[model samples]
Target: MAILTLGLATAGSSGAHPDHGGGREDFPGEGVADGSYKQHDGDEGHLPAVSRNVTLVGKAAVTNPSGAGNTGRVADVTAFGDYAYLTAFREPTCENTGVHVMDISDPAHPTEVTSAFIPTSDGSYAGEGIQVEHIDDSPFFHGDLLIHQNETCPGETPPGANSGGISLWDVTDPRSPKPLAMHVGDFTNTAGGLDPAPNQTHSMRMWTNVFDKKTYVALVDDEEATDVDILDITDPRNPVLVNDGLDLGAVFGVDQAAPTNLTSVFSHDMMITKVGRRYVMNMNYWDGGYVMLDVTDPRPGKVSLIAESDYAALDEERSARGHEISPEGNAHQSELSPNRKFLIGTDEDFSPFRIVAKIDSGPHAGTEYTATPATDSKQIGEGTTISGAVTFVGDACAPLPAGTGTALVERGTCTFQAKLDAIIAAGYTAGIVFQNHRDDCLSQVSMAAAGPIPFVFANRFAGLRLLGVPGVTEATACTMTTPATGGESTTVKSVFDGWGYVRLFATDVPTKPGKAGSIRQIDTYAVSESQDPAYAGGFGDLSVHEVAMDPENNNTAYLSYYAAGLRVVKYGKNGIQEVGAFIDEGGNNFWGVEVWKDETGEQYVLASDRDHGLYVFHIDC
Candidate 1:
């Protein structure tokens, strides 16, 4: 039987180091509806008594070719002088995905103003976040200079590998936003050539320098360090690349891997806080923690690694107490206070990420308290065997003879891990998982170490079944007859199938907003001890991925998970919660999220669902 890998929480308060953390004053404030106390030190005690009046603000369904698998995966969101913008990309198929626009004049309600295509079908834009700012040109400035990352190659067909370039949008009017320029310059001419096998860019940050009166857009190129590309957007229509002779790292920082043109690393998601001539760029990581870069000079600028934090070693004692982490990369997304005092890093791990608050500014800032997982708490599944050999479509185990070896399960039928975990929990150690049929021909496989046993994965259950009896090396050369048909089982077609992706979900909703008014009251829809073949959820027991707050109200947030559709959460006092979930009956899935505010303050949510195009919704009584 497989053992459960339940671990501990985060470590306790660290001793008084030199205290190089930033100050609370500089951190961005949530801007509570009422004059509630705002304490940065990660302390919730100093705040005043506030009732959770959060109500469901509704959601806007986003439709696109990528379908339901891409909901709530809304990568990045930022509010500028007078607008709120969102960005999305294609997954699975990696088709035509681009930057979308919504006017958030009214926080509660949002209007879809425009959506400009990224000007290429080479690969999905894979755009994560959006930023818009007006230059000093009054009426002429009507055109908002928008910047975003393009992480796909420029000429490759969809459903294959992805390459990318950065995109610039010209949103002079709310109704007709257009693309002004696209800078694929960085990847346009490498030694391997512009259309380098994997042509793409990852997470990017854009900012306007008050000192130089220049607008800069920085993007991290997957694989290599020095992947920071600087673009001058002085003119909204035309953009120029400033930083050169270097490499653009991955959006999520470098790890024990080589830099690739189409991988994510370095700064997955970052924020550019302007403090005078100096700009603070907080980059996320693979293991490099959060690095603060000093980009005062756009040209020939210097980058430095300021601070680093690692959850990999938060001892079982510390983890069990409260800290729990998934094997995901560190610092998925981060936001900065308007003042730039505090930096909030949201680790995209399955569990909650530690919210590090910098109390005293300038080289002596003290760090303070409070840490919670991103999703609701729940007991993880143990381990079990999974099998994809029985093609439900075929209604029979492969033509191969039924054997006594452990079963290798494929991911498509239901929640990827749940099935395997069930097998282990029910008393099986050697489980094999197969790739989804839709994946073109490439598969990303990993072994989930449930205690001491091994959980291996393959392109199909047939592969695992072959490995079961040991010494079954030449899988392509062996054949066996099935019970019904006297024919031999089919051979393994492809090893690198395109169907594997890491699915994560929350354990349970926070009883309280853990972070003051920003806490989202979670509705424990229903917990199950085993995977109901009928339900066939996603990876985690729930199958959902990430949770995001209403752009305007922290209490109101959206939940996006595959098969679960989109869930609108409302947090209230004394444990108030409600869910407005729109599910897909035909296997559609959700993965990303972003709230676009219309001119009237009304909020509109955009989500990427697999098979289901982008879904748009609203939160009103």
Candidate 2:
């Protein structure tokens, strides 16, 4: 068996203090109702709240606190030796547009080492993905290399600007990182007419093997019909393209299907791990679930597929949920356990809902309804029925006739909250139900405030049924029901919504010649036991975003539970157990988490909050 070991060395400590940068903020305002918290202007003094064992040792805002477009929010972080590299998702026009280098010899207070940005003439930026590795023994180059993804949004590329791809930097001198190479993709020609908007790299990883005597980086092309792009970086100054693109469907005999949720066939993220002597690449193929590839022989174009996960059956089941299918099941990202016995995968479902509306009374009585709760509508109680005369209000975007009936039925337009407010002011008290203006089904609606009365939504077809009911007029009485139990109330039942959860898979490495190993589904972990009223009948309040396994302990996995904060879980012969958690009271939209060790061999959790800045925590368990 090939036992792969990561050769990481600890660096001597260096004491340094934080330095503040001064400049006029560019881009948009810090906070503009982007669903997360408003950016606190010049509030770098704010620190993340933590549990008893976890400490807020070091804190720094990479971007100008007064700027806009994710200015102060740190996107990702990577630790190597005594320094930590952080990526920020700020506007291209901002001064701090690239990776922020921090001297972490002193964990309590990380000092700014340097700031590095991609060398571009048209004012490009870098931040999305980053990885650092030592290549001292390589024949072509020897030193520390920092690789980061250069991502551009659709139609945001400046004329004559280099297309998005990967950028390599030599950080041997932590205080001054020098550019090594810039690799861009060909956007003019894309497979299956897939649009490579903004032409950029979505995610990437660097890998090296002593026995193979080669180093490579895998890049994900975030365009339709595009696949994984592999590059040989043995010579950091001159990266060679080994594979233009590796189409998993064509190579592994797998077929593509229509996306049910947010999942697609496009490659989102990939991780290369050494299992024994052989290296395997586990890819999170959006809707494709998890795919395993044999990259042991990563010769320019000789990679082979070991096994690809099958999610067609799962997709069929999700499609059966009708138009209200939750977005919880789309495989967004994944990570393998330290022991290599299990693979932890996460589905990125940010917008979730738990709305249950049923038709009460009339010919359609007893018919169950799937509706979205108004962003600002008040939560209805169990056994609470709103029965009143049905009155049709014109298109909600425009001014409605004065004093429309109490139970208003309006067509969706503008904002759900705005429509509700207008009707309520005109004296509509019982409730409101908005029908879809488009022919397509209404998936989910974001209501900003819960109005004074209950509110529900229906698709275009359901609206038609309600409008055509016989004997139904402004005086016709209809009722809406909320479950009596299981939801927020003792009698109210919670409705299921969203498609975010974690799944585990197991793989056995081959030990002898002519012997083949097997990969199969093992166990799964979710927030099903959550007692939070918000996720009652939904997919739970915790939408597992990304996971990082403890390097020292294979059984422990740290998860960035969006909204639920950080969660520590352990899995082994005893099954999965919740070991610890730290939920920031201020609110947490954690997108990434990494497990790093200090010189004393103590482990710590580094998390990136999409709304706030970076958070450092010491795991007690």
Candidate 3:
């Protein structure tokens, strides 16, 4: 771990942030409605967020032209020249879910370039993984390029709903998008699934490897072992999948039955840039921490690990709340500094609170458990009384027999939500689904649990322990085909832990192209209220989502801090220090952040507010 330091985060009781205002984290395509809205409550909910040296230049509300309503339907965005392209999120009309181009000539009044709207398939949507890149040296194509991930909307499929994989378009002209490649790397939805979907393309980045004189795209496989994808896009029209399903566990040496310091491990987001002549990729794999790879070749077998970060047994954020607990892994999104000296990452924990259980009566009784809320459901009441009675078990992939209690199911077979649905029909109130295979054998991953039902997504050992299978350890391999067995009374109880925050890695530069380096963890940062239990209950999410480096200065990093608004921090020899912040009147729910420096070299921070549209801010101080 690197040198640890606490950010000058504002506290929960300070009245600087917005009231929870009954708002909940609404995932893009899942569309889980916030059920906590209270009527006529207080002034804090509508109060203007505290502003420091940041100034709002202009704003725009993504609207539905059909008038059906498109409130908060924006996800990721990218900027090039005087225009920016935005991705649609859970659009009111799923069919119309596409990319919107914004004319930013007049930063004070940026408007959507409707004519440039790049729509997806008939019944699908996009996620937070849209990127625009310029392949300066590629011979196949010469202009600006855009790539997007297509995900099928929740519920029924609308006819030939062919979705999944990455789509490419030439956006040299913001208004007239020329299709270069459509759904090039899609995968089947199920086993031997006929209709393919681009479900795994959660977050991706493109770059031109100077060493190879070619271009490539590295994307996340959200739910599969083929987690890291590097597509050769030297020919914009015909992309080649250089590497398929490269499992992190197999490559990182943490996936096997060894005891890993990292808890949750999966590729989520990535940033690619150059260090001298070497091309490096900084990947944020949940609890696996930040990993830097030498991707100079941008091909399958050619990639090699350069460095991986380690987490503190009790990181700064956890200790902020005075808890001696370990860091809740969420290494979400990150990028190395332009100077190639350090990397800044944001750990997004929508559900700040975590669930840790202990074996109550077995030989392994009193042992600590690895757990995280699989569902974003309502809090199971304040002081933690075990909610339901009895416990049932089965591999949740199938419809289990009726059992009116908590359901203990195995992972895989179907979606987490589908498993919950099956158990609910069988009268189960909550779920405890464990890892069914090696890919997820020992990790505690956060789920896009789609319903109101609460659930606990556990590691493989947790499931076996509940089934009364003794001698289970981190090294025990899981049987993918075995269904867990347990009566409605397996011994277990739940307790809450601290929220998620941020990590800072000090860069250890590699020598040259295809060389290796060690990127070490030097420190961690989070908003003061993030670890405060008082803010955990409400005030929206006090956690940071995404960040962008100031093109004007590498030490300056702008953060899209959800309910706490936009935060401006400067990283120095000591650590990161917050310099400014902003939350609009009525509060702001910022999602994605991007720094755009126009031809004039003036840098603007474009923030996507989940409740509102987009807000452009400039760091004045």
Candidate 4:
């Protein structure tokens, strides 16, 4: 029911906008081998060409009845002792209950410990924010702690009323998980009111400073304008909000007082690393680039800006689209190198192609609509034009007023797949989806449904433009439901603008007391097909999703590439280079990954595949 929400920007600032919070990211990509494209069976698109330097020692396809969004059966993976905690995330409907327990003592055969599963929150969903740590210093309990985010099912409210923000449990005994905190942030009511329901959150990190010895959780709150929400979790029984809804741009912008209007920049993900006594938080902020902050004291007045990523200039080849404009900024996620030398970031571009919807005639004739892809349909493969098409607006979300069944889109009542299926059945060339003002109307997300014809998704502004309606923003709560096309002929030109990739930066950690630290992007990496036109449309999205660093080898990191598979990279002063990669014969749609070591200190990578299940691998190089 969600489309990539690439809305228009007004002004204000994260500096990227008036462009709005950055979130244009993710998808499949390029073929690695020379053989022909092998079409995948369960999932759409061809299997990425294979390559292997990582060995799959074991695999566990966790059981999860598909959510409405068709999310990965298993999301984030974290290990404590011989047991691994795998979080289940299916939006709208959480059929899988909660977290899945897996016994990984035997690395060669990872098995699910069904008896140890935690279902504290039926609606509790965790995406890339799942961590289990043995924090013996917490005042609450001297045992293992498990924390996961409850970001809710986008656009739909699930079961639990008090399960909105973050959930914490005492997992001291792998077989038993004692619930400590049900909801530990601003909670959303069943009626969508504020106060006990969890504030829609995406990613979070928990760390106990070696110096302060105080445990804290940094969360990315989607419901708040000032996204970063910090909490003191030293006592897991009751979390105290230390910094509530603090806008990173205002406090740390180049001009602290008048921070660049972070129009499109919003905090997405974060990496907490200890630099000496200072706890540095490297945040993946869309459009705002990666922002580094010092949170050693865990207070606003004490926290200081370490560095902020600036994409003012770039190598022409790295731009992908060759457009004169700046790169479509979607600073999705980031991780710092273990050696503290550099950090790698990802700009997730789900819709690598931009669709220019030009109005041919009618009341608002000749006006063109171009923004992020909004319609949540399968890949269009090789951009093409949906020419000489007549525009019809359907109520996608709900049924039209009694007897009025003429809208072209599904609005929101049915799945985009259902709508796209109808469109294809009706012989429509393509489709476009815009976000409702209620949720992230300005954010860009990559949610899709398989369809034959091309489908694109955009933000509220673009949606308004397509319907010839005036701009209805997230603030005003645009409720004008009537769809109007003004009887115009539409020409939709799908242009390939390249997919999301990685940006490597050389970081400078300030040694002097008053000196400011900084980060300079050293290089960019994308699959050859993602950069080349010859491989366009045939191969799936080559965009990188998440990266897991190898503790044993600081120079080595593992990437869970959607269709590209697991890629191993080595980085240093020489920059980053792919040393190894592994893609199953059927291709891989990996979402999240974690690196865990067994009792003998043998390191292995755990990845969550969207269509498939869990995969365990060991890096050879």
**Candidate 2 lDDT tens digits, 486-576:** 1000011233344356666676655222234556666666654332334533222356778888877778888887556788888775456
Listed in order, each prediction's TM-score against the native is: 0.50, 0.65, 0.81, 0.76
TM-score of 2: 0.65
Candidates' lDDT values, in order?
A: 0.39, 0.55, 0.65, 0.63
**TM-score, cand. 4 vs. native:** 0.76
Q: Write the per-residue lDDT of candidate 4 for residues 334-388, one digit (tens) a residue.
A: 8887778788887766445544456565556665554333223444445455555
Q: Pick the candidate with the highest TM-score.
A: 3
The stretch of ten residues in a row with the least summed lDDT in candidate 3 is 8-17
* Per-residue C-alpha lDDT of model 1 across residues 1-621, encoded as one tens digit per residue: 322222211211111000010101111221101101111122221112211222334234333444544433233444443344545544333454665454545544544444533333454554455666766632234556666766542223333323345666666564566767654436544454545433345666677776666777776654333356666666755566687533323322334331111122344555666544466665654334445555656565355333344434322222333433222333454443333333333333222222221112212222221111111112122222122222211111223233333434444433324444455454543344433443121222332223333344333222323323222222321332112211112111101011111211111111121111111212222112112222322222233344555545534556564443456655433332444655432333455565555555555665654332345556552
Top model number, lDDT: 3
Worst 10 residues of 4 by lDDT: 29-38
Candidates' RMSD to native? 17.0, 12.6, 6.9, 7.9
Model 4: how far is 476 from its true place, Å?
9.5
Candidate 3 to truth, TM: 0.81
By lDDT, rank the candidates, best first: 3, 4, 2, 1
* Residue 285 Cα positional deviation in candidate 3, in Å, after optimal superposition: 1.6
lDDT for model 3, please: 0.65
| CA deviation > 4 Å runs, candidate 3 | 1-48, 65-70, 91-95, 156-161, 186-199, 254-261, 367-378, 387-461, 471-498
Model 1 residue runs over 4 Å out of place are 1-52, 63-88, 91-96, 103-122, 137-142, 153-163, 183-185, 188-198, 223-226, 236-238, 244-265, 315-318, 321-329, 338-341, 350-621
